[model samples]
Target: MKIGVMGAGAVGSFYGALLARAGHEVVLIGREAHVAAIRQQGLQLSSQGETHTIPLHADTSPAALVDATLVLCCVKSPDTLQTAREMGPHLAPEARILSLQNGIDNLAALRSLLPHTVSAAVVYAAVGLAGPGQLEHRGGGELVMAGDALDAAGFRAFDDAGIAVRISPAIEEELWSKLVLNCAWNALSAITQIPYRALHAATGIVETMRAVMNECLAVAAAEGVQLDAALWSRIEGIAERMPQQTSSTAQDLARHRRTEIDFINGAILRRADAHGIPVPANRMLHALVKLLEDRPGLPG
Candidate 1:
């Protein structure tokens, strides 16, 4: 199997290395520095108390995706449309594209830009780039993929690569549930520059998270998405599941790069406004994150 990971940051590099290790041909389309490091010394993957340098194809050009059978779109939500447009001409006609991204809007955005059945995957992994061409996995590595278009070969390939995956018919609800979690935690983590365990242990944090999540749920209800009843429990349990892991938003802030906050909490804000539902909690978090993005040097 030839797999191309578009925007091969932490998540893409992690999965690409795993697939490559399983004997599949994997190419990572990433930033120049990361691509250069991979070209020089292969991709370095550190996970489960082990580190290995796995050799694979890496490029900064989308043309590297020309022959890929599976394409994982892992770019930030804001870059979805632009990345899709860049990679569109290079994708094989039969290539299976999966949006292994944060937020709820990326699936529709990609489908609109590409001429393929773009599947959505609710990714439950804590990964980050330790450095150029180096991926560090914190915890969790499961994917709940949308739709049944994944063939037997594809499923077997992912399984052989040590990736746990399951297809779900109700992916919209999954995406919303994940979004609710993001709305509840990402900004708080970003602002505090702390891991999930620390944040959850902070004073008044759980109640604040609940408030944000409830606001997001109200918006989800208005949009007619029937999220799972156990979603809140899942959200609260993230602190235990990935105790040392920080939110992707926190990682972005630490790197002084842009975040997907606009799509995560901001998505809720947009819908809430449309539905005339006040989401003050979501709004405050979104604004604070945006303020931080706009003023990266703002003193804590």
Candidate 2:
């Protein structure tokens, strides 16, 4: 299978390296620095304190991906619509493009651009770029693929990549579940500049988390979507499992980059208004993250 991974960050590169290892052809389209590094030295996959240098194909040009069987649109949420439009002429029509990203609306944004070839999944992995062409895997690489739209062959292709894959009958529900969990952690952790465990332990943290969760649930309900009630138990489990893990939101704000807060917390607020629902908790968290983003960092 020929796979075009549309980002060379830690998540995309790590998965690309794995598929390449599984004897499939993998091409990574990404930023200039990463392209140069992958062209010079093969992508380095570092995990569990061991580093392995793996040879893989890479390019900075969108045109380089003319023949991919699968296109993993792994760019950040805000980049989705633009990236899909850019890949419009380059994408193979038969390709199964997966918006393997953080939030739920990414696939919809892609579908609005290229309606025929987009899918969504709930990513269950933690990864980050260590350096140009270097990917560090922290944990979890499983994915729940969308059930209704994909073909059987699509499922096999992902399985061949060595990913723990599931063809979910209710993948949208799964996506919403992940969103609820993120609503609890991403903003709070980013605002506090603390890891999940520490942030959750702060004064009134449980109440705050639940407040956000309740707001999210209200919006979900008003939107006529059913979410898993057990989602909070899984959300709390993240703090227990990765005690020191800081959210990607925290990491992004630390680097002074834009967050998916608009989609995570702010999405609820937008949808609440559309659905005639009140999301005060989410509104507060959204504003707090925006304020935190505006405030300059402390002395380096």
C-alpha local distance difference test of each model:
0.91, 0.82
Per-residue lDDT tens digits for candidate 2, residues 96-170, read 787778887887788888846688877777777767888878777888876754567667766787888877888
Instruction: Please identify model 2 stretches exceeding 4 Å from their true place.
Output: 148-150, 296-300
| Stretch of 10 with least lDDT, candidate 2 | 291-300
Residues 206-239, candidate 1, lDDT per residue (tens digit)? 9999999888888988999878889889999999
| Model 2 residue 187 distance off true place after TM-score fit, in angstroms | 1.1
Q: What is the lDDT of residue 79 in candidate 2?
A: 85
Give the winner by TM-score. 1
TM-score of 2: 0.92
- Give candidate 1 regions above 4 Å deviation: 296-300
